[model samples]
Target: MADYHSPTVIQPTIPSADMTALERLILGHIFDTEADGDGLYLFAEIGPSDSFELPVRDLRRAIAASADTESTVNAYISERIAALTDDDTHVEIDLSGMSWEFILQDIVRRSPTLDHVTAISAFTCTRMRPDGFGGMAVVITADAIRGKSTNDIVEDFLGDDAHDALYAGTHVLLRVREHAVKEQIAEAIGADPDLTSINPDAVTESDIRSACLDVVACSDLSEEQGAAEFRAAVAAIRAAERRDQAPG
Candidate 1:
């Protein structure tokens, strides 16, 4: 056989899992994954593979050298998506309409080949939600790409969902603020003798806090504002009671 000439122009191949991990890291940093209004949230610089294997730094360096890292990451995503099997079991979620938790469970149940790790890593949310406004993506850090718990991933996604709802100025904020006010007022009532003694037997602290929260929850106010209003309401009620007990 003639002398074999090694090709110098060819690039060394890395495992597809490693490529997926790095691509996810790059994409996560490029988009608004957490709905924080920050497009570039750098959770991790060098995400590790599922096996905890380190990627070839040179491959990362080459991508960084590219003029548009976004395009480079997209190309990698496309390549991976193309390699996916044509199995009918594979499922991707449209977070715009469906619940992430439900879809995640469905993905696992439907796709026998997908364990928790692969299911999470291969899920559409791991990259982007096609139906989201501007295709809102999820933050797939090294831990997530390396196979974090499904519950953790789902929880994070739910948190992102909440953030998105808040960022969009939806009713979710109102409900969350109201719930917080109720808890804060409950805690205050528990700690303050004055609040507890206002109507100990006749009216439960729970009832009082609920009534106060009703007024506080009318407007979308900060927890501090709500708490302040709640305190003031309790004080007024206390003052009125004291006047009624005063000798005529």
Candidate 2:
């Protein structure tokens, strides 16, 4: 159990040996400037590849200009292959999901020609929104807002580092609770203040719901919505009840 789910939840990587012949070729282009890219170059040269129809430059530019390091390039390639196929044998960029961000970011910076814009448009998500959001914030990705006006707004609200803002807002790295809610939950759970102060596991759902009502009493958030959203915000910690991320 952990307060925040680690990046390992999705693994986020496909080993070089596991990649299809064409995928290995695209991966080599991403790390073209890296000294360690030599290994991948050899793999691409030795390949007898299958048919692949991709906007080769768009995908390549996405990786070359992306903020991610070499490792993430591999992960992006993995995600691309997984998205396009039911089984593991195929590898192709479906031009879907956040994968479009790579090409879109590049397009916005350059001329947004008809063909270029058409290539990455109409992307969709295959998964549900994470419960960590609590509807308090929307997952506004960098590509979703790619103009001068949008940049200014995002800089003001989320600060200049839009990628970092997207990461922080979506992930549940910490939990926030009002002091009143803390004390009320402690009393309801009947646990020693010192033992349970840092972790509030024993508190029943009724107690949590009651404490949330106390929070709503002091705020404009509707009693029902406030309690539910508050619970959602702290869902990670509640699931891992006694887990503390701090190093001993």
Model 2 alpha-carbon miss at residue 126, Å: 35
Best by TM-score: 2
Superposition-based RMSD of candidate 1 using all C-alpha atoms, in angstroms? 20.7
Whole-model lDDT for model 1 versus the true structure?
0.39
| Per-model TM-score on C-alpha atoms | 0.15, 0.19
Model 1: residue 221 alpha-carbon error in angstroms: 74
Task: For residue 25, give model 2's deviation from the true position in Å.
Answer: 9.2
Q: Which stretches of candidate 1 lie over 4 Å from their true place?
A: 1-26, 29-34, 38-40, 45-70, 88-248
Per-residue lDDT tens digits for candidate 1, residues 163-220, read: 8987883333233344565567657767897766553334434555677677766855
Among residues 3 or more apart in sequence or in different chains, the pairs in candidate 2 whose N, CA or C atoms overlap within 3 Å are none
Q: Report the poorest 10 consecutive residues by lDDT, candidate 2.
A: 4-13
lDDT of 2 by residue, 5-109 (tens): 111010112233433343345544322212233222212222212334455444544445443433433465556543443333433543333342342233323
